[model samples]
Target: MRETLGAEDPSLEVTDLDAATAAPGDLSTLASPSLFGEPRLIRVGGVERLSEAFLNEALRYVESPADGATVVLRHAGGVRGKKLLDAVRGGAGGGIEVPCAEVKRDADRSAFASGEFRAAGRRVAPGALRVLVSAFQGDLAELASACQQLIADTTGDIRESTVQTYYAGRMETDAFAVADAALAGRAGEALVLLRHAIDSGADPVPIVAALAMKLRSMAKVLDAKGPAARIASEHGMAPWQIDRARRDAQGWETAGIGRAIVFAAETDERVKGAARDPEYAVERLVRFIAARGGAG
Candidate 1:
């Protein structure tokens, strides 16, 4: 549907629901166009947050959407927003629900990389694809950005070396790399990358945010208190991923995790200008976390 729409349309109205509210008037304007003419496409984004009233109205319109009008809804996949999803599925109409799950595995990352290459009207070698997947890991937005950067930075075809060169300094910009290194007990390497990140002008807040996310994931594994196999099965994660998280969690007691959370909060305050030398603050945080991990 998107392919056809992209090929046939010259104009598209893509709205981000996170940035826009959908009211009855808005839907009315969408359903009934101006006296001037018709739009080629009308997309309603962030559909997960649409109000119940707006959703019902939009569903009604979907039953008989205007000619040449295409309605695209972007949902980040939430079961709590299932009411409208059920309505769309049960309705006698064509609809698509793009599930944007977080990528975590090598196979999933390869699929995404290939899809991006295809989207850009290009081809990637198998070895090059593997390199791209490893370099970008599992973040869709980052992968997409890297694809755009590569497309602009190179011509003809993208190769493994191209990916390697483009990603030479990616570790400094990628907060996940820092978290992964730290979680794997590579404190010295993580500290070096953390320092490089600060020197390369990466903001401290996002680094802290990424670290908090890693800590929270570890805490989830710890608090699950279930067998690693059971937790992996229940969470749809690989046993290795679960086991690695378990080991990482062992390096921090509950009290230690609590203190890290507090430290993150203070670092956040400092980054927001409540304190001076945000870089030094984050450096101290990294050392403190490494010390805690070493103690464990």
Candidate 2:
């Protein structure tokens, strides 16, 4: 909004108000015509903790606002500001309602990263957006900062390789470690690591991706009848990765890999908000994968 509103104008002044202690007079000066005829932008933050006097003053200010000043009322959305909110909502003048909802889905975080890039006049590829979202999941601020930094530092479009270069193997290794634990038939250990990764602010989508990637690699090599180098090249994996997948697939028949893949897919859906408890869903996936390995 500041960008669109021409914040660079020398005549524009900004004021921050703590609504709890701010009186009507304090707010009145903000909306009043500046003696020097400058425009004012007043931001009244924490309206949810507003005092009666503050609310009354805001209401009064709403009745007759100054032409040269713009007043912005901020709230954290709670019951404490019910009266003030209702009054503003019911006002004849009407106000712009900007709703900032929490981001819960993988797609949401991706869209957020895309928006940040778009706002900075940069184009980002879908793969890069996904990588950025996964790298900074559950933390919008960090994601936004990274996006802006890329915008300021780089020119033109951003690709998945660029994002990979920026974050530098952030949480992907941890996510893969969880997948390794589950695939090695250590369900109990996998659960503990999964919990630790999640509680440490790891994104569930990437964790699920790591598992799927591991299983897919295993399935590929398990069904192959060629040299490790040729098979690894065909599957777009490193020779070492193929060798590791071969080792991990030791106890599994082709049937077990298929069943594990199915369970992993089911858990993927469950973790993406389909289940009541995503952590529980992941736990079940690990256990099922491990059990399938043992059965094979």
How accurate locally, in lDDT, is each candidate? 0.65, 0.75
lDDT tens digits, residues 123-225, model 1? 7776466456545653455575677678767887788677767785654335656766666667798789888777777778777777775576576687787
Which run of 10 residues does model 1 get worst, by summed lDDT? 11-20
Best candidate, lDDT-wise?
Answer: 2
* Per-model TM against the reference: 0.47, 0.43
Write the residue-wise lDDT of candidate 2 on 1-296 in tens digits. 53545455656776778888887589997778878888788877778789888887777777777787777787876898777777777762365567778666554666667788876678988657655765675446557678878887888899878876877557774586688788888888888888888888877777887888778889988877877878766765545556777888888888888987887898899889898888777777777777764432
